[model samples]
Target: MARAPWEGDFPDVFVNCKWKSPDAKIICLADHGLYDAAKGQRDMDAALGLLDDIVLEKTVSKLRGLERQYGVKPKLIAPAAQVSESNNALAIGYANWLGHELGWPVDENIFQMKDFSKDKLNGWVRIAHRSTFYGEIDKKTPYVIVDDVITLGGTLADLRSFILGKGGRVIGMSTIASRDGNDVRIRLDTDTQAKLEKSYGSDLAKFCHELLGFDHRGFTDPEADRVLSCSGYVDLRKKIVRGRNEGDASRSKKQAAR
Candidate 1:
C-alpha cells in the first residue's frame, strides 16, 4: 500500500515507470509463502534448505487438510510451491495444477532474458537476477507470466520491457506469493501505450483483469510465521525464469509465419 507513482485518473491497474511511460500499466499479485533469504546467498532455495531452518511448503496442503477436516473448499485457496525449480516449470506446474483443479486450459510464457549491451548504458545497470529481454510478445495465445514469489519485482520490470518491446501487451500476471511489501510504480511504455491505442482504442488496464483474472494469494501474519518457521526457503526466481526460456523460443516460429 505504498504511494503509487501514478495514483489518480489511471484506469484499473495502470501506474508509472520512471524509465518509460508517463503512464505505465502496473498490476500486482502476492506470493504464496514466505522465506528469509540467506544473507550473501543469491540462491534463494538452496539458502533456505541449509541447516537451521524450518520448511513450510504445504500452505495449500494445510488448507486442504482443513477443508477435508471441515468438508468445504475455501473460495480462494492459494498454495505454496514445494520445490525450487525453473520459473517456466514453476509457472506451468501451477497452471497445470490449476487446470486440474479448475478443469480448463492454462498456458504460460516467460520473457526472454538478455544482457544489456555495454553501448546502451553508463556503467553497470543494476540488473536483477532477471534482466530485460529482446523478443516478440503476441497473443490469441493464452498465457500468463508466473513466479514462485514476487518481491521488489525486478522480474516484472523485465517482463514489461519484453512484452511492450515486441508490440504486445500483458494479458495478466500470476504468482504463488509475495513478501507482502513492494513500492512499485506502474506505467505503460511508449510501445505498450501505442499498442494499446491501436488494439483496444481505449485504456488497457481497465480490460486486462476482465480478460484474464488475477490468480494470487496473500500471506497472513500467522501463515507467514508458519512458513518462516520452516527451513525450506526457495527464491527460485532466476531458476524458474531459466525454465521459461524454452517456451519463448516458439515466438520466432509464430513471427516467421506472420
Candidate 2:
C-alpha cells in the first residue's frame, strides 16, 4: 500500500521511521499451547516476572543451541519490554542468566513506557496499544533480544526498531514460548501485504498510520493476519477505534481512582 498523503516526510515516534525488511532470527523454546493444561498460569507468571526452574532451564538450553546453530556470538543481550505491575521482568532475569552462561553482558538500557499486556486485551485492541521504548543504546553493538513470550511479536518488533534507530544492531530474538505457528518476525510478508491492500485498499494504510504512526508494513505477520481475518475495512476500523476508546476510558478511570 502506498503511504498516506498526510504522512509525508515524517518520522515514526515509536519505531524506525524508515521501513526495513526483518532479518533477525527467532529462537523460541516452546509453543504457547504447551501450557494449555495450566491455562492462564503461564501467562500470569510471565507477566508477574515469575520464572519456574524448568522453564528457565529449557529456555537457556534452547537459546544456547540456537546460538550455535546461528553461529552468532552477540556482544550484548537486551530483553524486550517490561511489566507495569512489577520492576522485575522475566526477560530481564533470562537475559542476565544467558549473559552469564554465554559470557556476554546484559544490557538493561531499553525501557517500555506503556503497559500493553496482551493477556488483558481483546482481539485487535493491541493494534492500537503499541508499546513505546526509551533509553540509551550502544552504537554498533551486536545485541540479541530476549522475551518471556511472543504473540503478535509487536513488543519485540518495537524494541528492535528502537535499537536499530539508535544505531545498535539486532542479530537475533529469543523467547520462552510463542503461540503455535506464529512467526515471530516483525515484518509483514509481501503476500500478506498484497492481500491486505486488495481487501482494504489505502484505507487500511491510512488507519494504521493514524493509529500507529506507521503503515501496515510495520505490522507483525500474526498482526497482519489478525487484520485480514476481519470482515472488511469498516469492521476492522470499528474494532480498532472502539478498543482504543475503551482502553483510554479504563485508564482514565484508574487514574481518577488513584
Candidate 3:
C-alpha cells in the first residue's frame, strides 16, 4: 500500500499569530471570504471539501508529529452559535465535519452567550464583555480549537483563554481560512509596531494585546487594523494549486525510482 501522507515527514503549520502558546500550533486550510448567504454557503462548502481532500491527511501527519513530540493528541473544540444574525452555523458544520474526519469528539455546549457584541468597530475590545461559558469543559484534555475563518483573531484569542480558564490545555489551533490568508507568517517588527502605534495610538495597541489574550502570540497588522482586503481569498486557490503541483512532483519522483 502507498504510504499515508502522515506516515512521512511532519507537516509545517505556518501562522501569523500564535494565539495560544509556543507549543500551541495552528494549521489553516483555506481562505474564506465574506459573501451573501447563498454564495457564502457555497464558498464554505468548497472550503470544507478541501478538508477531506487535502487537509485531513496533512492534519493527521501534523498531529502524529505533535504526538511524537508532546506524547498526546489535543481534544478538538469549535465555537458555539452566535446569538445574532452572524451566527456561525456554517462554521459549526465545518467543525463537525472535521471532527468526524479526525475521529475526534467535539463539545459544542462549552459556552452559552446572552448576546454576541455588535460593536466590531474597535475589533479588539468588543467581544470580551459579550460571551460567557457555563458548562464544564474537560480540564484534563489538551484541546485543538477549530474555526471557519480568522479575521482579526479576536475570537481565537478569547477561545484560548476560555479553554485555559476551564483548566483545559489548548495545544493546537486550526482554521479553514483567515482574512489575510497569504500573510500567514506575519511578524510585527519594530518599524511595523511603531507604524501601527502611530496609526491606532497606544490605547488601541493595548486593546490589541487584550484581544489577543495578552499572550503576545503575535498578530498581523491588517488583521489588527481589521482592514484585511478581499485579495487574501485568492491565497486559498494558490494553496490548492501549490498542493497539487507538489503532489504531482512527488508522484513523478516515485515513479522514476520504480
For each candidate, give its TM-score against the true structure: 0.32, 0.69, 0.51
Go through the candidates in order and give each one's C-alpha lDDT: 0.32, 0.59, 0.46
When sorted by lDDT, best at the front, the candidate numbers are 2, 3, 1
Q: What local lDDT score does residue 117 receive in model 1, on the 0 to 100 scale?
A: 17
Candidate 3 lDDT tens digits, 28-145: 3322223233123444455445445434455555655555666665566766554333344445655677666666667766664523232233433332222344667888767766
Q: Which candidate gets the maximum TM-score versus the true structure?
A: 2
TM-score of 1: 0.32
Candidate 2 worst ten-residue window by lDDT: 11-20
The list of candidate 2 runs beyond 4 A from truth reads 1-52, 55-72, 75-88, 115-118, 181-186
TM-score of 2: 0.69
TM-score order of candidates, top first: 2, 3, 1
TM-score winner between 1 and 2, please give it: 2
Would you give me the overall lDDT of model 3? 0.46
As a whole number from 0 to 100, the lDDT of residue 208 in candidate 3 is 34
